[model samples]
Each structure stands twice: as structure tokens, then as C-alpha cells.
Target: FEALHAAVAGLPVSGSRVLPGLVLRRDFAAYCPASGELAAVVVTESLHPALSAPGVEFVVGSEGQYQASLRWCTRRTEAVMKRLQSSNVKLLLSSVKQQEVVIYYAKLYGVSVVECLSSEEIALICEITGVSPCTPFGDNGEITETAVATFCQPLLLGSKRYVHVGFTSVCAFQPHCLILCGPVDGVNEQHAAALQGAFTMLQQLFKTVDQ
Candidate 1:
């Protein structure tokens, strides 16, 4: 990861821009079953500060104070809920993983989440989509709409735990290809050397095409 970050930092940009003009997020996975239905949810407004804040606590000396605080919290939650319900957004807030949350929101909001991505992956996606990646959260992070194309196929290697997941945003021109190999065990030296050779050849091919 450090090497990847350094490589991205070393990329040349114009006008004193040191960092590459790309958005790269790690440990963010948004995937849904291909056979499942997709729904659209547009968030027309930003969330309230009270609801968006990190933590909530109330110091109350009496029942009335406690009740008031509880009421306030309820009202805030209901406000957000009403907005989503009216907008036809599906809300999943119970014991859900981060990846699940991203998937749900993406499905509701008509967007796609690029997961387990490296810097190179990010650059490729941006080149394909012709749009900068949006942050999942923040002032500029709110996305209006995004389209994604997902491709999934089982390796059928007799291991259910190993699956290849990948996607790309819709674009006008042809996009680059990136395939990430999963971890394997009990590989001989010959196979390792062959794999390395294949990887190097692919890299050279990409460089040639780019040039």
C-alpha cells in the first residue's frame, strides 16, 4: 500500500499539482448480487448536523429533560427517515457491515461502489468514466448520480471462498483492464515463475499501448 501511494504521489500533474487528479479509496467495498433488483434513491439535501454528528449524549437531572432530549433525537431520526421514505430510498441500519451499507445506498441511489481498489485501479476507473470519483462522505462527497457496469463469474476452482469481483463505470471510450489475482497456496517454483512472467508481459503490453 505504501509503495502504491508513493507511485501515485510521484505521478506528474500540471501547475504545481503534486497529487494525481484522482480519487482513491481503500477498504471500501460496495457489491451486490447481480441477480438482485436495483432501485434508485436521490438524496436531494444534505443531512442535518444533529443527525450527522459523531456521537450523541444528554445530561439530564430530571425526567422532563430526558424526555425532551429523547424527543429531539426521535424527531431528527424521523426527519431523515421521512425524507428517505418519501424519496423511496431503502434504509438498512441494523448490524450491517460497511460494504453492505455502501451496496444498499448505491442500489437505492442508482450508483456503484468500486471496492478493494488500488491507485492504479482508481486511475483506470476515472479514465473510463471521464468523471472524478466522489467521496463516500463529506461536503463535496455527496454524489447526484453514477452509473456502473458489473461483471461477475465464478472461478469454479472447487473453492467457494475465492471469488473475483470487479466493476467499471460506464464511459464513451474503451477502458483499461485490470485483473487482481487472489492468494493461493502450495504453488511450485515453476508455476510462480510462469505467473510472474505473465504479469510482466501484461505490464509491458499496457505500457506499449499507452505509449
Candidate 2:
């Protein structure tokens, strides 16, 4: 709570409550989604531009966080179900939902949801791996891997072509995993090596328990 409060103070923006968009880092139990599943959800307009893709569909919602799209993602479990229901909808990468919310709704809807690393956690991963989050405030790490992968991977993979405004959250499984999002091609070898080293060190740290 103190960390979040401090991060918020650093931001020029002000709000009574911490918005999901403002979240840079968080920690919680991991949730598991069923294998080979596709999900969708309502995202904030702030996020829609960066997130908009071919397979994923979007509809305007009151708030960027919880809206109709999330509902659709939850209710429409199978691609087959979505197809049978609507010809226009297409599934891209699965939607990233909060772990706690996913667990509660998964049981209620009988649809499985996956646990994702928090935005700050992803930032730490990049730092540990030697890759910079590359934002003015270094707060980009506050986003989710799902968001990061969607926006950043294209830049890394050479599809998106231009940098978009606002932070796109992304995550990775490796301890020192570094995901760079930008029109810039190929992670420079130096950064890549650092990421490799960081990941190695992190792995060793975790291995302590196993030992």
C-alpha cells in the first residue's frame, strides 16, 4: 500500500482511488486457466488503442477497467461458442484478468482464467534481466505482461511499426525475462546479454528453495 501510494504521488495525475491503469506493480496468488483457452474482456479506452488487434474485438465501455468486453470474454468461453453466436467476433490473444477476480468469476461462470504477473513484477523482471522499461518515469513496468506482449511484442517482432502513447503492460515467465516494446528492432545484444545474466541470477536465487 505504501509503495502504491508513493508511486501515485510521483505521478502528476490525481484521483481519489487508484485506477487499474495507474497500477504499476502488485502481487497476489496465481490463478490457472484451463489449457488451450481463449478469453476476452472489456478494457479501458486508455488501453484500447494499443491493444486493438485483428483477432481481438472491442466495444466502448463506461470505464476502461470493467466493462462489457470483460463480460463477453467471461461468458464466451470457446471460440466455437463465439463463432456460433457472432460472425464478427475474432479471438486474438486471451484477455488478461486480475487473479482474484478471475478466480471468483471463473467459479461463477465455470470458465477458467489464467494468473498473470503484476505490472511492477514485470518491471522488476526487466530490471533483473538488465532491460530498461524505457519510460520517462520508469513506471511502465506497472502494466501487465498480457498488455506488454500485445503492444511491445509487435514492436520487437516488427509489426506495429510506431510507438503508441500510454503504457502497455506485458509479462514473461522467466525470472530475468526482458520484453522490449518499441518500433526498434532486435533487442541489442548488450541488453539481451544482460537480460540473460539477470535471468540466470534470478534462477539461482529461486533454486535456493529447491536445494
Top candidate (lDDT)? 1
The per-prediction tally of clashing pairs is: 1, 16
Q: After superposition, how far is residue 54 of candidate 1 from its true place, in Å?
A: 8.0
Worst 10 residues of 2 by lDDT: 148-157
Query: In order, what lDDT does every prediction score?
Result: 0.37, 0.31
- State in Å the error of residue 110, model 1: 10
Best by TM-score: 1
Model 2 agreement with the true structure over 147-181: per-residue lDDT tens digits: 22211111112221211111233433222122333
How would you encode candidate 1's per-residue C-alpha lDDT over 1-211 as one tens digit per residue? Answer: 1111111122222211122222233322333345433222222222322323456664569998877776675554345434443443332211112334335544554333334444554455445545454332345433443323344323222222222323343555443222222233323233345656886899899999999
Model 2 ranges off by over 4 Å: 1-90, 93-187
Model 1 alpha-carbon drift over 4 Å, by segment: 1-131, 136-142, 150-157, 162-193, 198-211
